[model samples]
Target chain A: MRLGAALRSELSKLFRQRGTYAGFVVVLALVGLLTWGSHYHQDRFKVANELGPDFVVAGKSITALFIARAAMDVAMVILMPVLVAIVVGGLVAGERQSGTLRTLLTRPVRRSTVLLSKLVAGCIYAVAVTLFLGLSSLALGYLVFGWGDLVLFRGGLAILGPQAGLLRLAEGYGLAAAAMCAVGVLALMLSVLFDNPLTAAGLTIAVLLVSGMIEFMPYFEQIRPYLFTTNLPMYRACLKASVDTASISISALYLLGYVSAMVLVALWVFSRRDVTC
Target chain B: MSASSVIETEGLTKHFGHIRAVDGLDLSVHAGAIFVHAGAIFGFLGPNGAGKSTTIRMLTGLLRPTGGEARVLGRPIRDRLRVGRSIGALVDEPAFYPYLTARQNLRLLASLSGGARAEEIQEALKLVGLDQDADRKLHTFSHGMRQRLGIAQALVPRPRLLILDEPASGLDPEGLAEVRDLLRRLSEEGMTIFLSSHLLGEVEQLCTDVGVISHGKLIAQGAVGGLLAGGGPAVRLRVDDARKALSVLADLPNVMAAATGDGSIEVGGERDSAQLNELLVRAGVRVYELRPAHRTLESFYLETMRAGKSNDRPDAEKAENDNDGSG
Candidate 1:
């Protein structure tokens, strides 16, 4: 019961802050930009030239599902991860910098309970931002471009009906949300080590950029599969007409492992460190 | 720990690497009526870096002591689940969600400590004289208002004990008096208040018991009246010819006299006030007023600190002597 109160308090604090809604605003702008950009280039729109020179551009192909999927793909590159980083990075470090952590820690709440509530709140924010991007893109695309079948050219050509494609887009969004949550947890752990929210967020994004860069390094190929960035893009596998359940499950497990390890690290440091701030 | 002691610490030590912020110190604060009409207001007095805040932090479970253990209200300091609920604290500065209103901040803090009813929150706000301004955002508050809100938050939980660090830091004279009266009222209601502050006069008037700390060590701890009365008998005389009076008192055997800033001569050491008055009068110095001087907490604090510093010098000399002999 005490933990429940603390969680409610934590969530209230998180949602009440002005910076918490920044990610949603960024998502709205990105979705709007992507929707308009896709429409402007609809005449020349093609998944890939490698799919075929004969596969001509069709305006009807720019459907709501396709646009939503496109928005996720574009956002996952840097936007969504940074947004999650900013949200979760401030969960603990921001309070510490502002000297509010000392007041909260001195209460009846346990350190572990505080960390857990923040972790859950960060993940909740991650999911919220991701879903907001996905839904906004879909809703705006339907109003502007209309709905139709989705033609995907990832790993070869695959045409999916609107219902099947919407389901696939939903699955992709869910998986993307999970990946962003893993990123949030990673930022949460860094937040425990840093007293500045900007420092933690910047470090998380730097780590993400470095990890993304490492995937292309020939010398790092052996360790590439184990890197978190490799697993973050695993949502793409769900976007395929023939979803690889086993591969998705393995990637989900890796994300879970990373989240659990990060949370444990956060809890250990927060519980043992002195709250002089 | 005594049966009536509300706070007890055994060798409570906290070392920040090379600096010992709080050394091995034992202290006990009893809860019964010792100085006040009821309850007990224990003031932990110290200089800037005297470990007063460090000790209070440990008791509040904000910082973990390196080498000692403490219990508050019968529960170990580490058992925050029980102890935290029973203690209300405002450590260092009053910090809250700047975007949150004062009432909101109190309510949020209240939820953390087993929750508080609406009336309890209102009563706490009213007690701190913040009832009308409780709806204002903390960002708009001045330092004094923030300090009052800090006290209000501590009282919202209605704990058995209050641990405040410099509670009157940013208050004006009126606010200070209000806080003093409020604390006295709380103590009379049988609440144990353990506050750390350097306001000696306030401590002298408000606290029933005081513990003096210096360089992370407890130099003195006892009743305020006892500590003040324990000093040597002294007398203060307002005389027309201050220099002549100083010269006259200097010839006396045991009297140590000096002209105070307020144009009065303070004579320390064992001496009768009437004898000194007559001696000054005989020396052609018109004595305006003469009375037995009462030692202020400020003097007691300074004397205690000086003695503590002098005591450290010998220990350092002995350690140096032992080192030289070994070499």
Candidate 2:
């Protein structure tokens, strides 16, 4: 019951601050821009194909699901983590900086309860941003390009009917939300460790960026499976006609493990930490 | 722990890295009448860096003590949630989300402390004289207003024990008086207040019990009157011949120390003023006025610090012994 109150309080404070919604606005704008760019490129492709290569016309149909998938790809790789990092990074560290955590901790609430509430709030924010990005992309995509069968060229050309494509997109969005939550949890752990919000957010993003870069290297293939960033792309697997269930499950498990480990560490450190500020 | 005691500590120590912020300090605050009053108002008296704030933090569970244990309202300090619910605190300064209004900030804190109703929040604001300004964002609040808001937040839970650290540090004269009256009123209403401040005059006016700390060690703890009336009851005699009065007072068996000053002789020791007056009358010294001189907490604090400086071990021990003897 106390945790619920704390969560409500945290969410209220989170939403009241303008910085909290800034990330959402940025994500929505990015999605809108991406959709428009895709539509414009698709129009250019139609003109090019009509004037020249018949082969280009075979793989050129821009379906709503395809636009969503493309937008999700961009979001997962860059904007989504950034959005999650900004909010989660400020969860604890920002409060510490403002001296509000001192006031909060002085209440008749356990340290663990406060930390858990923050973690839950960060997860909620992560899910919200991810879902917003996914839904906005889908809405904008359908508005511009119209719904149709999704064609993919992964390994070989595969075409999925509209209904199957829509289901895959939904599954992909769900998996992407989970991945973003893990990223948010990781950022929260960093937030608990640092008193500076910017440092926490910057370090979280930097770690993600560096880990992602290293995960793709041929030499790091052996350790790639162990890296949390490697599983971020696992959401893409949900887009396939014959989904790699084992790989997707393993990726989900990895994200779960990462989230659990980060939360545990964060809880331990935060509960023991002195509120010097 | 005694039933009347609300806060007790046994060698409670907190060391930040190598710096001993709070040394082996033992303190007990009884939860009964202070002097003639029905409630206790303990003034945690100390100079800056004297570990007053550190002690408050530990008692409030903001800082973990390195050694020893403390109990508040019969529960161990480590039981933070339980202890916290019973105690309302304002540590350092008032801090809130800048964009949030006074009412919003209080409401947020109130919810954390088992959910305070809107009327309760309004009442707290009214008590702090912030009811009119409750809708103003905290960023627009002056330092004094923020301090009042801090007090209001502490009062929101209607805690049994209010632990404040320099609560009136940044307040104006009117704000200070308001706080003083608020705390005094709260104490009278049966709230146990334990506030730390270097503002000796404010503490002197508001507190019934005082604990003097220096260099992380509690030099003295007892009733404010006892601590201020150091050594014994003091009498200041205004006489025609100060030297003669001093000489007369020196011969008195009960008189401890007598020194002649500007038109008066300050006498220290346990002795009746009437008896001394009679002695002066018989000894041929014309006594114009004879009044009991109460030593202020400031003088007592300074004397304690001076004594500690002269002989660190014996003075601290003496202060503690004095406290015990008086308490």
- Model number with the top TM-score: 1
Per residue, candidate 2 scores C-alpha lDDT tens digits across A206-237 of 99989989988999999999898988778888
Name the regions of candidate 1 deviating beyond 4 angstroms.
A47-50, A56-59, B29-38, B237-291, B313-327
Second chain TM-score for model 1: 0.81
Question: What are the chain A TM-scores for all the models, listed individually?
Answer: 0.95, 0.91
- Compared with the true structure, all predictions reach lDDT values of 0.84, 0.82
Each candidate's chain B TM-score?
0.81, 0.77
DockQ of 1: 0.68
**True-structure RMSD, every candidate:** 5.1, 7.1
Quote the lDDT for B166 in model 2. 93
Per-residue lDDT for A206 in model 1? 96
Residue pairs in candidate 1 whose N, alpha carbon or C atoms collide under 3 angstroms: none
Q: Candidate 2 chain B — worst ten consecutive residues by lDDT sum?
A: B29-38
